[model samples]
Target: MKFSATKSTLVYALQIVQKAVSPRNPVPTLSGILFKTGADQLTVSATDLDLTIECTVPVTVHEPGNIVLPARYITELARRLPDVPILIETLTAGSAATISYGQSQSNIHGFPADQYPELPELPEAPALLISQGKLKEVIRQVIFAASTDETRPVFTGALLEIRDGALTLVATDTHRLAWCRLPVQADEIISIIVPGKTFTEMLKITGNSEEEDVTVYVSQSHVFFVTSVMQISSRVIAGKFPPYQQVIPREFSTRIKAVTRELLEATERASLLITEGMPVVHFNLEKDACVLSVHTEAGWIREEMDLQVEGEPLQISFNSRYLCDALRAINSNEVLINMTGPLSAAVIRCPENTQYLSLLLPAQPKPARSE
Candidate 1:
């Protein structure tokens, strides 16, 4: 292969595909990036057998061929190279390649193109069209609650369900759950479990504007996300998502409406004061206000935020970290808190929009140490 591309354009494509490069996989080509030169563009691809990323950029192609070079070396070299066109050429017979820049040149041995794994072929199904901005927002709202424990495979990813015209995404870690719903036009009912890691990477490539649409293609085993210049494909997690509807609280004993930012700030401060053993923040919902406090060996925290209170008064304790995460995800000025009891599942939602909500299983904090 032989190609020359501007440093800026070349570095961008390399950096985008480098995320899928295997760190130390047994397959040599998996750790490298496959570079294919075409008429006037360079197509870069990398895969770790599970997730694959490919990006294309305009470049000057002297010869149309393919090679696989170390992702780490190529990306780092392109990033540090001077602002000039860089050239890469491979030998006719051997796996030898040379990178040329102004007054400098370096040689790197590459793997034969045949050794690289092939990208998955998309099924001939209708593509689901969705606004890139809406998808990005929904993924951020729920993906953080996904379980990181790999032992329980179902809980490690988010449940993606599309029925009628509503698209719902739900994620849970046993202790807490977060869900969001969006409306879209769909011809078929679709339900699948998408790995949270894949959605996290999708956020990086998808544009934040609602004008652009992302075409989603689902095969029997793999899901593909395609944009104008990029593509991301991942294997679907093969498991049934839990029945998440049973856990959402429909009744409440006490309801509090407070400013989202105020509560988030208080929870962050309380989290800092909490110790390793006592990771709880006690919420004392009194008349007309909510008081947040946490008692630890280091000190004590007591913050009061005023809001509209309804129903009965109650006190509940929850993991400070969990509470902070839920609060930060809410994209609203005013948040509604519905408490069933001290030990029951407490719900948090935006007052204006009912599409998103989070549930937290209250925690028992250790008692205050001796003064």
Candidate 2:
């Protein structure tokens, strides 16, 4: 295969597709990237069985052919090449690839293109087109909460539910949950568990702008995302997510509305005084003010912030990290905290929007002071 492509363009495409290349690939061929040069374009593809990424860039092809070269070497070469056009010619008959730039020459050992595994064929089905910006927003709001541990296979992936005219992305790591909704129009209502790692890669490639709509292909075992010149596919995780709806508190005896940034700052300051074994932060809620207190053998801290409260007085203990994460996720200025009892989970939400809810499990009880 003979092709000439701009160094900058070739480097961009290589960087994008390398997200799927795994160093510990089981198959030797999987470690290399498949390069196919057609009449007008050159394509590079990489896959690790579970996930695949492919990108195409404009190129001048003198001969239409294909080859498989080491992904790592190609990416490094392209990145370091001089700011000029690059010429690549592969001789499959000899299993060699020649890379050239200004006053430079390099030869790389490669495998026949046929040795690479064929990418999965996208089936003809109704696809959903949604703005890349909105899709990325939903992912940012929830992907962080996905369980990093693989013990619970289901929680390691994000639950994508398409119903009516909306798409909901939900993720949880048992301790905290994140949910985001987006407006979408699809012919069919579907639900699938997509691996969080795959979704994150897709987000990285999708970018943040809504310049174009991203096409999503869904099946029982696989999900594919197609952009203008890039495509990503991943194997779906097969399992039912936990019943997340039931865990959110519905009613509360005490409610408080406070500035999100203030609450987050207070929690961060108090968390410093907490120790490793002990992860609890005390919340002393009164009529119109809230006090966050943390104590350790080394020192103690107390933070008081005023808020709008319209319920009975209450004091609760909770994991400082959970509250801080939830507060940081809220985009609005004022946040609402709904507490039912000292031992119950406290529901956190934005006062203006009811679409998002965060639940924090209470910490173990602390010793009471003798009056």
Candidate 1 lDDT score at position 87: 91
Candidate closest to the true structure, highest TM-score: 1
Candidate 2 versus the native: TM-score?
0.92
Model 2 root mean square deviation, Cα atoms: 2.4
Instruction: Estimate TM-scores for all models.
Output: 0.95, 0.92
Q: Which stretches of candidate 1 lie over 4 Å from their true place?
A: 206-210, 365-371
Instruction: List lDDT for all candidates, in order.
Output: 0.86, 0.84
Clashing pairs in 2: none
lDDT digits (tens) for residues 1-371 of candidate 2: 89898988898888888999986777877888889987699989999888998888889998888888888898998899998778999865847899998888899998898899878877678569887777776787677778889888999999998898988888888877888777788878889998999978876774325767789998767888888888788888988999898887889999989988988998889998776775778988888878888877768888988788769899899888777878887878999889998988788887777666677778876786432
Q: Report the C-alpha lDDT of model 1 over 1-371, residue by residue, as the tens digit.
A: 78888898988898888888997999988999999888899989999888899888889989899999988788988899999778989999637689899989989888988889988986777558887788888999999899999999888889888887999999999999999999888877888888888888777763325567778888878888777777788888998898989999899989989888988898888888766774788888878978888777788889988778888888889988888889888998988889988888889999878899999888864555665
